[model samples]
Target: MTNTNIQILQFGTGNFLRAFFGSMVQDLNENGNNLNICIIQSTSSNSLQQLAAQDYKYNLLVAGFKDGQKIEQIREITCVKDGIRLPDEEEKFLNFAASSQLKWIISNVTEAGMVMKEEGPFEKFAESFAGRLTQWLYKRFQTIPQSETVVLPCELLPDNGKLLRNFILAHSINWNLSSEFLLWIEEKVLFLNSLVDRIVPGFPSHLDLKLKESDPFLVQAEPYALWAIEGPESVCSHLPFLSSDSEVILAGDISGFALRKVRILNASHTAMTGHGLLLGIQTVGEWINSSDREKFLLDIIDNEIIPTINLDRDELKKYANDVLDRFRNPFVSHKLSDISLNSIAKLKSRLLPIFMDYKVLIGYYPPNLSLCLISMLLFYLRTPEKIRDEQEIKLWFKNVSKSQSEIDVLKTALATWLDLEWNSSFENAFNKVRQ
Candidate 1:
């Protein structure tokens, strides 16, 4: 167990955090930082009890390209000090929040975790991750002094920290917190918006037997990783605990990073999920193994997506080529379904930009982007059928029914969301396929 008084509060224990953030923190501590980590599951039920009981110990497998060679490494991480359920262990979490030694906070609670309702500030007791974070921040404001919190949100959303801070502030208004507290939040807590890239395929437990037979020790990861954060100078100066390399950037404005990531990394990944699956390419390696898929991905990146983004084309092209090479990693078994988890939000943030830009610039919608939208619509409509929970499936079906016909609704929705026009050609292109 990491015994440092200075601690990090992590909001998720899934594989991505385990491999990326967890490993990074472990590296930070091993290199003389002595930082401990306390993990929290936002929900009331503590599903991570067993993992916590084991002292948050987990083995991470990293595979793919490194130094121009195929590399695979398995590492055990042991930096987590403890784990708890936020609602069930509220006192502990609040105590940690108020602790003088607590310096940094992190969360990767998915897109759904970003929502905050009109209830304003969190209640005396709340269960949602956002609610919990708000309450924790309030506790810190009430108790801690002389300094503030540094929050790095790793959720795959645009302006995530800004949105989260807004939710907390809104909650404060709803909860009738005082102006003093609000002022403190505005001044003390620094919410750094970040863009994190790592295709951690997670623990391949299902393929454990096969992996053992071949390599006895095998881990999975794309050969690429990047984390870019935009924050104040103070935050940048105090970021030695993160990493000692240039991979993590504390930029003046993250808009450029956001644009580059969304245009190349995210856009290509979403496009590949539908098309790759259709081509029977299950893993990223399989997708890369095929010249056709590789060429298609590259073509989309160069022709459709790149022209829409505002960055230097040559630089982005170099990075995009490197990203493509990472996709060809042999050991990582990244799944289309996993990447397709939040397709709706992914489309809204990543692919929608290219879709709208192509429409405006070229005065014609691209077929490939249209296909991605269709895949999302179909996924939203029919994917719910295979879900086992009747209530969940019913809710999804309800959403679909509330939506217009798949094609019509998707076309209009994308156009409105992207702030583009719904012209005849666009409608006809979208209408070619039925859900």
Candidate 2:
């Protein structure tokens, strides 16, 4: 009998992938489709061993509001057919890779995970994440010449899938892999850009011991989830599971969706964390649940952020509303302190673009967003986070020559941080507000 389940090899046994993608696949499998997954953590760490002991069965507790009412469910995932830890089970991992049924190469190895550090021309299973993946794909290339491979990278980095493919190709070049194989990779391989959103606070220590005792590999998550993938229609057609899954969108152009997410949800986190801290708010849900803070965030996003995005206004607003609903989910207690870490860069990548755009197009400094930036600066200046940021920035905030020109200096510093040219008009509103 042929095992008809669509074979997928996933990198990372972490909480996010398990709770987000893992649970989703489990859902797809249970509902209608046959999607079996093989798990591998592409590192020396034997993290999947613990997962193996649980017989690859884990409890997923999804909690949130549905139709304006509280709802929660605990599901046991059995779709995980096998777990392989790299280095320890390298042969087994390759064996799984050699499967004729393998379809998509899904990964959540994180932003820094897809790096290429050149050690030798190409040692098998090279040290860096990109290299190891190249070696594995080469093995796949050799074993399964007929099968079409699609790379679905769930990492949050911009152009993640595109960059990942490029990295692999670059590695292949450095390694002097055959031009035929390289051309095969370029011509045949499908690298689909993906964006994943969900709150999976792993092994909830905060939950009561009785609840935790439900399953050894218990994972807690909010009901709301999104997996936006931009890929070819044929790619979507291959995996019939996505047809059943409403949450996993097969988007036409994922950049707009990615921009909306990065600019709004993620940007808001950067903009509001320090302010939320000021309000004595602990979790993201707590902050967004507060009517006052929620309105404030909404105004900023609705007014300043959404207008700039090229997507349909109605669709953007709908997404914004959904974002708020996700934020208000009581099940996920996303710590403000956690989000505030490495925040300067977060602000640069997230909110700062909106700021720059508003300045360029609207011809006015965005009051709410500017306030958030000022608040972020103040928060970092006063707290232990000051040391965590660059010394130059900290010192610039501290030792600006003219005390009266603080707003101008702050604006200039902000521009410099984002590599934008500073304009006096950008800080003029802040100056007026101060006066």
Candidate 3:
């Protein structure tokens, strides 16, 4: 019931969105844009309750290297006017969706959130994130058909916006909605495929004692951020933040940017996580500080990943070097376990493409990439309980007996789950690395 007009309806309340999108909107509002955000908790997390307790305002710490100089800035975020939890507050969410002032719908529900799961009846809130979005869009269509809304999905997946639109349409058809609704979505709605880059290590427990005030939801992130959105020039009109100093790119095609990020930044994280965790490394800073592990990661990026990408090699190298610097940021404590969430999905989206491309481009399977696969398998074998993934994926790892030898486990996991062929080279590499 705040008097501020909620022009943006966000789908997640995670640290990344608060630091990246929320901060950008705050900047826009400061520069004379009166737009405010209404955050909808996509999951059953207590973040909404906490955000509400604080009047939907929180502190964000941006600390990292920028232009080869160390920088740290803390700011209070006040762009969020209200917060609502899905299903529990479905009526409130739908009411906000019906608002004519709402022009943008943003989400950062991670890679797994894009999946379409089995949903119950439309009356009872659907389980999947996509299902809930489908319902919300339907409500909006019913209330304000003429009003156009832009959807910017910030998931790491390539072509995420199109994927989400298809999911919503599929859900609409499943719910037996009218053809007009689908056509309305097609004509009025704009789903812009976007790639967001930021490293937000949620709730800096290490800096709690140093903080000036008590905040249950303080989010810390690196200074570098890029939100490359693919859409026409007119789309910029809907987003007032583009006028600000934020690095928001409106390109005809963001595929190259997406590929570079996914293959370089995200793929390096996934490739390093298993090995880093096994080596008793806790934070990304620790992993990069270790000379041996750092070299291992750089080798995969320079030798295997960069060659597969069709972009300019020098540009890719510069980006890779910057990624290493970001990792070395002393202020951030990005946990590998956090990055390890849904590692299987991450592997497929971020690493598997590079793995295939390396074979095609390099004329052979990359040895370091092979070691990454084996390392992941070994990590999963050793730490099944700590793994957080889909139930099916977790169950698959749990069913893997500890009695089996490392080679057998690697062979079975690669062949069955990943559909990857194992060879003597991979076996030899695994043996050497494991020893």
> The CA-based lDDT of model 1 is what?
0.70
lDDT of 2 at 228: 85
Model 3 agreement with the true structure over 1-435: per-residue lDDT tens digits:
533388898888888899999889888888887888888886656878978988999898888889878888889999998878777877777776667888899998888888887787888788888898888889888888888989999999989999999999989998899999999999989998999998888878776545636787888989888889898897778666677566988899999999999999988888888777877778888888878878888888989899899999999999999888888888989998888888877877887888788878866677887777677777887788988777887888889866888678778888876787788657866886678
Candidate 3 backbone collisions, by pair: none
- Cα lDDT tens digits, model 1, 1-435, are 222374789888666776667777777767777777788786544457867665666666776777787766666677777886756777777777668878889898776566775443345676466677778888888777566788889987889889888888877777787899889988888888998888788756544444444332233555466788887676756576447332677777888888887778877887777555544456666776777767777778888888898788889888898878777665667877677665656666777767778879998877766665665555555556432222543365446554466656555545543455566655654565442
Ranking by TM-score: 3, 1, 2
Clashes of 3: 0
* lDDT computed for candidate 3: 0.84
lDDT of 2 by residue, 125-170 (tens): 5666778778877887888777778788887767888999899888
Which model scores highest in TM-score?
3
Candidate 2 versus truth, CA RMSD in Å, comes to 5.3
Model 3 Cα shift for residue 84 (angstroms): 1.8
Ranking by lDDT: 3, 2, 1
RMSD of 3: 2.1
Candidate lDDT values, in order:
0.70, 0.73, 0.84
Question: Which candidate model has the greater TM-score, 2 or 3?
Answer: 3
Query: What ranges in model 3 sit over 4 Å off?
Result: 1-4
The CA lDDT at 359 in model 2 is: 71
TM-score of 2: 0.78
